[model samples]
Target: MADLASLQSGPLRDLPYRVAWRARGVHAGAHRGTSSGAGGLFRDLATLLEAPDPRRLDLRASLRDPFEQLYVRRFERSTAITIYALIDVSASMGFVGNMRKLEVAAAICAALSFSARRIGDRFGVIGCDREIVPELHLPAARARAGAVVAALRTFRPTRRGAGGLVDAAAQIAGRRKLVLLISDFQIAADELAAVFEALAAHDTVPIQLIDSAEAASLPRFGLLPLADLETGRRRLVVLRPSLHAAWQRERAEHEALLASLAARYARPPFRIVDRLDWDRLAAHLMEARG
Candidate 1:
């Protein structure tokens, strides 16, 4: 753990979002910022109200609205656990990892962020690759949603580039906060464990997001070559029945090792999110909240 973890929440709590009466042109002190108006120190004035379209009928609706829609939502002392979306944009998180894996990870972060804001819990963004992009460091805010969303849009994965995560994690420690680290878990197992060990004092949830291909047995084929996203390293290996079996074994071993370390590291739960099955992971997080 280097100086990266030294980051703090600072006066962010004091510069809370204030409610601006849009129609009356007055400030309603009852609540902080709404999605419609700007309300704090880190906040500039603007109406960032979300206008959902009727065309794109999404079933995530029922839950999304009750938890996310800002229509008449009120901010309360959440007591809902704080969450930090630590996305690993290392090169490996790019292309072959399926169509929108990075986007999926980002989407999850946004979803959680929206939920936190709704429930009055503070949520922050910590995008990590060679280093954490929120380099200067800022406290998370409900009205800062737009800025957070913008930061996530530019994320691109790179190789062996996460040279700063360990340090960054060390800087931000809080009471009853939850750190949701979503990455490919591309680093060495031992190194990964060491960082988690250092942050054991705070609640940290490690969500390792891998592609669908990485999670299952190989496809029926003649030959397949693979490239290492992180190191720009490449090697051509034939896809064979025996080779596939061996691959599964090795992968399983790695998974088991991580599980063991996580179980030992912190009482806070950790998870594995791949392209195929994240429903279980989602359910686990909700349960942890209870």
Candidate 2:
């Protein structure tokens, strides 16, 4: 498990974070944007009729033209992206394997916040339990890494309900943002559907944190006591080979459904087990941009 103290110790932490969706903000930053702006990266070249900026004129190309048609360079805008770590601090996220899921969530939040700051983007964190935790909702700002880590350290997954995600989504409704929703996603499909609809306005990345044993490879010979992590309900059942097979099949079906839902929103879900894999996440973001 990554210690919080160590996680926040680096102020210069960087990640190759690329915005997968088009950014709408006008402020200059490091991510690609749809609107063209001054001092932006090269996008393409266009004919004089399309782009009339004399300052961007390609003199060599104009000289080489047989028809003497002028050409101009075009550049894409790089703008600031607001990155919100909408973390699920419900009881389900407290499950432990090598480390608690909540710890993994904290690590992810810390890393993301630090990386966002490194790139001059605004970073914020929202802790969602029974509802969006009022004290844990930090509005996006630059250079708040220390405060964000402190807020993360105060989170405890003690909530027993499953309807907080919709509330969390509503908090970010009016603005375009890059939201990283860290959760186990144990809620009912109907509830999740509602949350998905509420988050349709932003570029949402669902980070599904799972315990290793819960995801796969359970022992099939013993009596296992299974408990609803959120509802405080428990049951004891003999884990026979046939029952184990059925469990595996059910898990596969659920994952398939999640993939389908993410595809519908044009955001593929990323999964991490027992620990937050920062490299994997950074690589996923890089590939997403392409």
The best candidate by TM-score is: 2
TM-score (C-alpha) between model 1 and the true structure: 0.61
Candidate 2, residues 1-290, lDDT tens digits: the string is: 43435544555445666766677787888878888856778888778898878889998988889999999888998888888888777888776655567666666766777778777799888887778777777888887555655666656677775567788777667758877877788766777677777777877788888777666678989988888778878999998999999988877877777777777763789887665666788887666632
- Deviation from native of the Cα of residue 208 in model 2, angstroms: 1.8
| Full-model lDDT, candidate 1 | 0.54
Weakest 10 consecutive residues of candidate 1 by summed lDDT: 1-10
Range of the 10 consecutive residues with the lowest summed lDDT in candidate 2 = 1-10
Task: Give all candidates' CA lDDT scores.
Answer: 0.54, 0.75
lDDT of 2: 0.75
* lDDT tens per residue, model 1, 1-290: 11111111122212122212211213232333323332232222111144343332334543456555433221221123345666677776775434345655555655666566765666777766777666423356554554555455555565466655666676676443566666667666766776677667655667776566655567655676777777788888777788878877877887777677667754334444444233565555644321
Q: Score every model by TM-score.
A: 0.61, 0.80
